[model samples]
Target: MRDFTVPAEAGLRDAGLGAGTTIALPSGRIAYAERGAGPPVVFVHGLLVNANLWRNVVPTVADAGFRCIAPDWPLGAHQVPMPAEADLTPYGVADLIAEFLDELDLTDVTVVANDTGGALTQILMANHPQRLGRVVLTPCDAFEAFFPEPYTPLPKLVRLPGASWLASRLLRLPVVRRRPWAFGWLAKHGIPGEILDSYLSPIHDSREIRRDARRFIAGVDKKYTLGAAESLTGFRKPVLLVRAADDRIFPAQLFERLSAILPDARLITVADCWSFVPEDQPGELARLIVDFATDRRADVVEEEHGC
Candidate 1:
């Protein structure tokens, strides 16, 4: 095992590690962690959580005759210094991701996206169809401006002045912050100290990133997502939808809409998974990813994807 070290000047040079590769994005250097040796399988995380969220899944895919690269965006837990005025919309963020992907010269990439990332991946697949090989989306909150019910509306509220402070404080409460007990799934990615520190410490370490919570909320573009869905539903690539039976954030009702658009796409549901199914079922997810990536190319046909 090698060490992945992150530093300011070295910038994207290391992730306390000597393996993998990194590159400079518009905002700053992107520290990409890589391992194993084989075909490229890029793992991208959603907002709030960085590559660490994929820690459990990296090796699973890597060990299975595939190369894995996990890139840390400057916006999130990596705490990259944001420009005083950055357009952090879904398209804006996807542009940076596209830039990162281009720099890596990664063509035919099997892109795996979760949560907000799933939406971004959809955008990438639609806009940059030629660059994509296959896609895997899971527990994603795509397609709908109004977020699913029973979610911490605070994520959107975090943009307001007093709202973020309220969130930081509220998250500290055991009663209020207890992992959803409705199902035992969230327990896998619960707020344990190490998990909390790995995800939150970077943002907490830098007071500047307090603005990120604001940026994260403001970045949500329901329009862009809807358009991406429009494009992705007709995307000419193999797509696998990993549905968590107990996802609390993304309403399952929308799955019907998703299926209508992605008619040829296969669906895999984890009966006992919460919002963070990738963390809970990394191996299963990894296998599905490999299968999706290697499957035959599917052509797009125009139709009103049962929205």
Candidate 2:
């Protein structure tokens, strides 16, 4: 574990995540920002986005007396690129997440994940549930819906020669990026220009970053998500499924199925939002997280005391 300074971006600064920290994992170093103190709440974001995805939600959760650790997972938008030999596959990334928790010695953690990150969290829960006390999964890929529709061709497309480079270059254009096929549909209200820039600049500027992105994209397969789904029934930990009322990407039925699968799970719907609930409903999301963590902790204490 090492402390480091990340170039302060306006988006991150405004989010008030405090100083950045880097943890050396077997795969590579992961950059993260943390705020507040007490029980840990780690934020995991999906592909093409970084820790900034939680910018609006972290402060509120942290202020509620939970230590919020948001990492820039190597999902294309991260500042630090992984080693050339690092495994960026879905299972490998899931292990990387487990390694992250172990390296930090974060026990009984509350993991909050969205988008592709939610799928990875499911994998972590199936394979590495020891550290996690509970999980909150917002809209994300699941079941056979991995990559979902319209975007399903991504894995095969990235395997094509120069596809990563061309895609990165095309995304640099504001019009192209804002198109429905790109990031436009992710957030209903739309992401701020600066924040969106922060999300895309890494892949657009660094060859290594593009390589990392390509590796992860090409490895997208539904088997990992399906396998996780199969194992979720045995995961006795509490889970909160936060579904978007108007999600254009992940269907509402995904959460419905998840609720049916998990032994202990609750499902709630948030209105007027798309896939990015943190962006569309940050305050509500934060409130839900804090309340769930608090309520679950209290329940545990009562059970321990036989109350």
Candidate 3:
């Protein structure tokens, strides 16, 4: 298995995410970082990103007396690839989350997710609600808009002959990734070079990684989310929906729609942020998570989710 440690230059430790660790799963070895020690809080990131997405938010929540576990799930940019024959579809990846929890013996966990991760969380809640305690979703793919608008073309791009390779090659240029239509829309501020490199290098260096990514892309569909929405309506567990005011990729109406669907959900809007709330509002995101987890009986919260 790969060492999977954060490089000294990346300075993840300084950002409060500490060193990396790995857990052996049937699919492959999963790399992760953990802090604090109490009822667990697991974080999930989206496509082309890793656990580093939560570098800032993890420690803040960890300091508040809860264990934080952030794993680099088998997205395109994960440092380690799943077994060659492993399934990389969205539902398959959702199963991986459930497997991770069962293997780690984590129970009644508060799952926090962003971007594509939120979509998976909805699936998990619908299909594997045994171990999860509650969930917090920051603007992500919902309903029949799995790929959203500007990004909807990605699935077809991955399916086109040699298109995945060409897309991977195009992504090699750092400048191209900084375009608004690219990863630039993910966060409101500039992403650090090292962090971005960590997210992009795996696919560049390994065909297997790219293969896994292509499979995930080909599996993207709104039906999975729509089905999850139906099951979610009956999900009585606590749910928190966080939306970024400045986000352009995911529609603002998603928060309201999701809140209305779930029997016990509250919506909060964070300003000056895009799709990635952890990057733009980690401090505020952390506070809301901790407060929600600690206060088990909060009267089915229906107030504004202000930071």
**Clash totals in order:** 8, 0, 0
- In TM-score terms, candidate 3 sits at 0.91
User: Model 2, residue 87: what's the lDDT?
Assistant: 95
Question: lDDT by residue for model 1 over 94-160, one digit each (tens)?
Answer: 7777877777777777788887678777777777767677777787767773234444363566666
How many collisions between residues are there in candidate 2? 0
Evaluated with lDDT, which candidate comes out highest?
Answer: 2
* Candidate 2, position 73, lDDT: 92
Displacement of the residue 246 alpha carbon in candidate 3, Å: 1.4
Better model by lDDT: candidate 1 vs candidate 2: 2
Candidate 1: where is the Cα deviation over 4 Å? 1-5, 8-22, 151-156, 169-176, 179-191, 296-307
Candidate 2, 1-307: lDDT as tens digits: 6657565442443357656867789889888888999999999999999988998899999889999999999999988889999999999999999999999999999999999999999999999999999999999999998888768999999999999999998998999987877898999998998888888888998999999999998999999999999999999999999999999999889999999999999999999999999999999999999999999999989999999
Model 3 stretches astray by more than 4 angstroms: 1-15, 297-307
For the record, the alpha-carbon RMSD of candidate 3 to the native fold, in angstroms, is 4.5
Please, what is the whole-model Cα lDDT of each candidate in the order they appear?
Answer: 0.64, 0.91, 0.85
Off by over 4 Å in 2: 5-15
TM-score of each: 0.82, 0.97, 0.91
